[model samples]
Target: MKLNLTTGIIPSLNVSAGLLGFFFVKTWTKFLEKTGWLKQPFTRQENTVIQTCVVASSGIAFSGGFGSYLFGMSSVVANQETNFTDALNVKNPQPAWMIGFLFVVSFIGLFSVVPLRKIMIIDFRLTYPSGTATAHLINSFHTPEGAKVAKKQVKTLGKFFSFSFLWGFFQWFFTAGNNCGFTAFPTFGLQAFNKSFYFDFSATFVGVGMICPHIINVSVLVGSILSWGIMWPLIGNKAGVWYSASLPSSSLSGLQGYKVFISIAMILGDGLYNFVKVLSRTIISLSQEIRIKRKDVLPVADQNLPASPLPSYDDERRTKLFLKDQIPIWFALGGYVTIAILAIIIVPLFFPPLKWYYILVIYIVAPVLAFCNAYGCGLTDWSLASTYGTLAIFTIGAWAGASNGGVLAGLAACGVMMNIVSTASDLSQDFKTGYLTLASPRSMFVSQVIGTAMGCLISPCVFWIFYKAFPDLGLPGSQYPAPYATVFRSMAMLGVEGFSSLPSHCLQFCYGFFFASILINAIRDSVGKKWAQYFPLPMAMAIPFYIGSYFGIDMCVGSLILFVWQKLNRAKADAFGPAVASGLICGDGIWTLPSSVLALAKVNPPICMKFLDSATNARVDAFLLGS
Candidate 1:
């Protein structure tokens, strides 16, 4: 629920919630061992299976996009648009249909990448950082010496978890009304707070900061400063000049237009740059590999030696097991075709705007794109699934045209494309983990399938809870504003309506940022790593342009804490930092369940801890005294 809400609001900060699940599993297994409840010791390979399953299941939450593509279809977004017609509005899918849609579409991607696992993991040697890290973590837990470190890490996790949960509970008491509590605290005075510059005391983001690289957090902070601190205020001064003065603040023709479009511009710019870069790298690398393989002869010394040096015993053993139970190429191909056919037939029953032909076309082209996404994820540990999804929105939405419910068609298409591309990359990453841990390929595949099935049911139910509990969800200024929903919806609208939909000067700003983002990427690449490492990511910066800097501030605080900890003791910080951060995130996240229940029950916080300036306080005091 926490991940869904946070990632919905800011898709870029999607952390792996599976790590938290892995922690619980590790702890539980330890407890079971102590109690002599287990017949066999929990092996590292088994731990890998649990991690794979947990990741695959939790991953469904992200692919579902309750906060982005799914939410974009809601009335909340339709109402936000000035020119949105009733004919174009799409009702949110019912929970049952959502489950069905997710179930049917989810597995297609799993099969799509099954054929490439060996090539990606062995031949390309893609890092797949998350998977490799999880493998290492599992290995550590099963070792004697590492057990001592694990105990300390678990203890630290527990301490922080308790504190984080208590902090959330404390904050809840003061959040009786809008702009109430420490969340709305004006750490930098009222003006900066109003600009969304103050920290919201979000433990989730703080934990996220610790987990994410420093560049991401810094990029967000930089983006916030550029947008809220500078660009927004400057744009506001031209409200009547650039657009109608009579327009509401929320109107797309006014300040909101600038915010949405410019952010989109930057996002697209960064995405395009990275996409091209990765594609070029993949093509070049593949060609080089082919060329090398095609060589018919070797030097005399090399020819006399074995074709390849013998792998270490561990590597050879792992390779043997990985290849022992290979999933047949025919099965993968057949399963993909079968699922594609089912999706083409079934999905339209729920979302009629997306024509069967569109699904067919996307499926036909998706495998190649999925491969690209998976390969890119291997090289960079960054999946551009959303980028590919955005491409679908523009291409399909434009093809559909506005008169034919293009908005709904585009969003639906995005769901299909995103799920396929995202799951492909994710599965590949898991394969890498399996390779490292010597887990059987067949077992990993089965776990992923089972996990995916579970996610199909669980993600929608979880989202349904949020949808039912929070009446104001997806609305601007609400807790889960689902920032990407608006951005994506707007992209579809732009595709259908073209530049005419943009407010005056908005297109110009977009053009400027679009090129600026490309330029920034180019410079980041050209510069040496020493300087490039310090550069802010255009994609990261673009997020805060819409959502505000509260989360960014929280992340920076997390980074600060980590920095201090590292300075004190680098080894301990490096070893236990993720555990502590995960604890903080998990504790705060678990609190969401109770909070939602309270909200649904119509129970409000006991106090509205609002802040007031001196004059207002004096006026209130005088009035009370006289009365």
Candidate 2:
């Protein structure tokens, strides 16, 4: 929870809890073995079970969106909006309801993807990079030669982890107030800083850059340059012409509206394109598979004129066990239907404005969306659960209307959609890991269920502590700003209020960007993969439009580091890059635990590190001398 919240606030630093959990469990298990506490050697399969459980449980933190959807319902957003209403105002989250809401929505995703495991993992052969990486990490730990490499990797991880933690501690002392530390450093210049172009000194984002593909990192940087450097400046010049000059800079009626809506437009355009493309491919693939199967079953006079070429030894063994415990199709369907009914009945009882039919409609369409998300994750290792959630937010929020608590309804629907879509993808990723590890499919599924059950209870409890301890938990400029909360809330507002709320020319800009995104994606696809890799992804570019480019700077720094390391020693960089990156990420992420405690204790940092222009500094000095 601490690590996720820390990373989630920044762009492109959302490290997987499972990846971090792997390090902790591996270290602990090694300690136990060394101390002679274990009766038998800790097998790779057992390690996999632990990893699956961790991923499942920690996933709750990501999906729960305490910092995003839940926070969007809070007073922070209400305070920010000019035309707030009672319907838009939600009470503080209660633990009981939070737990219940998560439980209802989380498991539906698990069952939703069960029937498609073979199709996704076996037939499609999509490269789930994160899952495949994890499987390799686990596999390496249990081998004699690999064990030696693992030890060196662990040592590298520890060294960097210590350094990253201490660095965070050093940085914390200067952050006594808002924008008062290295995070707010004006690395470029005062003008650039005003445009939100600066190095935040965030280790987590740097680590994320190391882990993420080069295209994603570069795309973010390009997006920042386009929006902040050229587009926003051009738009800002139209202040008095395009919007009211007297309006505060933050007003959505002015520049803020353009930022949020334009970003949303690009995101939607990119997501829609990919969703159509992936769905079309999936249908074609499935049709071909059916035809092949039908042909095989038809008249083959020779029982097997020539048997199909045998699979490789490891592949054959893994497939045998994977197929050994087939979760019945009926079971998957029955479980999904049962959960859907429960959610439809129970959710309206808690959130009446959402209506029963709304839930029914969402549930009906959710499975298809879940498959799209899962399949997309397999291909790109990027889960667009939030994009799907945004779709729900607009569709449902608009349907419910502003007079009928549309904001809350939209957020609630988002939770349901996000959890199902997210978990479906996560479970599929774990299935891929299981397939590679040669772990039993039944064990993987059961472990995920157990972990999810644990998460339902644990995630809300963890979030509750943050909610109570931090007085300004979701407020802008606070430690945990929960940036996406504002974005989601703005989306709900736009959905309900319609284009009448947008500033002059905002709608036109949105339209241009929307079509531009689609066109860019079309061109990228039309070009061969060799050239397409260089194209900036619309989705990746859209993120920094709303969130600022500071994190992009951090990520590029990470990319630079990795590039240099690879140049110096490609083999070692390939071997130890993730471990080093994980160290930096985990170390800084874990610091959130103590930082939260300090906030609870009301311990202020000793110094306020801030920068000022020469004129301001001279004035301060003159005033001090006079006094």
Candidate 3:
């Protein structure tokens, strides 16, 4: 009810309030439609939903990924009693120069992808699923005769949103108080199964099952089975040499640690292999087609805010020479050169430089890594930035130092590359969104650049708010797991303090996982995709290992709902299935707003955070559900 600035509580409160307010407006609009108060087939309310979703999406983009590690210091110099503000420099929301450097780097990422635009979007025509879904939702709102369909959709979406919001209360509030309602059934019996094999039950995850292609779902199931059903039981039986029972496992929980290690390796391995496979095949395939296949669920907007006056290429030769409406070569070249000089050559001059060439290497590697991430997204719709960033850690391994300067540089390089990858992937997906809905790609480009500038400033504030609210981050049973920071920290420790201090088997398993992922992907690609459809996607398989079985179970069941419905009536399935799934996603997705508030209030997360604690019989804590 009250505001707290020092605690970073205001930003999350604002977000939660906005989503609640939007839900109310949506409900009122539907009531108006029913009474005929809104005439002309809902002409007055057009563009309302799309605009709201866009804003929500932008806020989410601002919060996505481990953007915190950009400034979070894992190598803290303070005691347990030291206040968090004192420990992490307690400076401004973020370093100002870092903000400037991010802006230049983000802009450079946009510019660097110009050549890739021609090759991936124009020539190969990859269909990014989420982008297509967004395009479809937008098109539904704007097209002629789309108003009626979209109006109906709005009402349906609102009902589900309200339904899911209440449901989220059961999941979070009640669960925190140790009454998770029906969803807690999975944890009732079977200690091994509950702790190791439980699947989350929620409309949102079920919605995911309904929406994702069956092939992807099947792969997810395979991955889940391999880890929880097989690997988990194996670990319980053996307590194997590769998994030390005594090793620190707070950030990366128990058997879950091995799961995280192997899974990450597999994801990176498979993703890396897929990148090469996609890149090579696209080259061969491009020669066969002049233009690639592309989508629209426009179920078309000519709108892109912050519109730039892109040069209209009237020359036939110019059109033939490059993709239509491409950003001018001079602008690309000019932007790249200017940003590179500042980011690569000038920025690092401030601090005492050790291996000044590291920045240069990052300058060279970033764009290439960005392109690889974009390509992977086009092919898989999964961000490979984490994988690439992990790769960067190893790539820079031998050169990292014991001094603070070297670790800082490594984290900087990771941040720069990740920021670029995240930016580029978002751009590529938006480009796909534009292509499907008949929107102007160049105009979308202008809108994205504007958004990037805003994100450069806003993301830090969102991150810091979470930091201030949750003081003991990365501690066991705490909400902010911050696995990526842990990864970066481990890499630094290994480099600075040496490997003898780390769990030996953990490292070995990680490498084995890395290689196994690569090998499985190679075999799958070689066998032909038709056959590969039956095999699990290594990335899909690996993700579930770390994410817990509960989510995997919910997602699998959601997929089955869609699969069975399609089999029953394929045509009608198209008309209603997506709407239902959309409702579930909308409901549960924004529900995080209130959840964040509860979290900041120390409203207590469901027993799940402390599930391991009670399950392990550690001294009972007050936070544990039903404790």
Q: Highest TM-score: give the candidate number.
A: 1
lDDT of 1 by residue, 234-344 (tens): 988886788888887667778888988999999999999999999998889888777666653544444543465668998878778888879999999999999999999
Evaluation by TM-score, superior candidate among 2 and 3: 2
Q: In model 3, which runs have C-alpha deviations exceeding 4 angstroms?
A: 1-64, 67-101, 115-145, 176-190, 230-248, 251-257, 282-326, 345-356, 368-383, 402-408, 432-438, 470-512, 527-530, 598-627
Worst 10 residues of 1 by lDDT: 9-18
Residue-pair clashes per candidate: 0, 0, 8
Runs in model 1 lying further than 4 Å from the true structure: 3-37, 296-309, 622-627
Strongest candidate by lDDT: 1
lDDT of 3 at 228: 71
lDDT of candidates 1 onward, in order: 0.84, 0.82, 0.55
Clashing pairs in 1: none
User: How many clashing pairs does model 3 include?
Assistant: 8
Q: Which residue pairs clash within candidate 3?
A: 136-297, 139-298, 140-299, 199-550, 200-550, 209-558, 209-559, 295-436
Residue pairs in candidate 2 whose N, alpha carbon or C atoms collide under 3 angstroms: none
lDDT against true structure, model 1 = 0.84
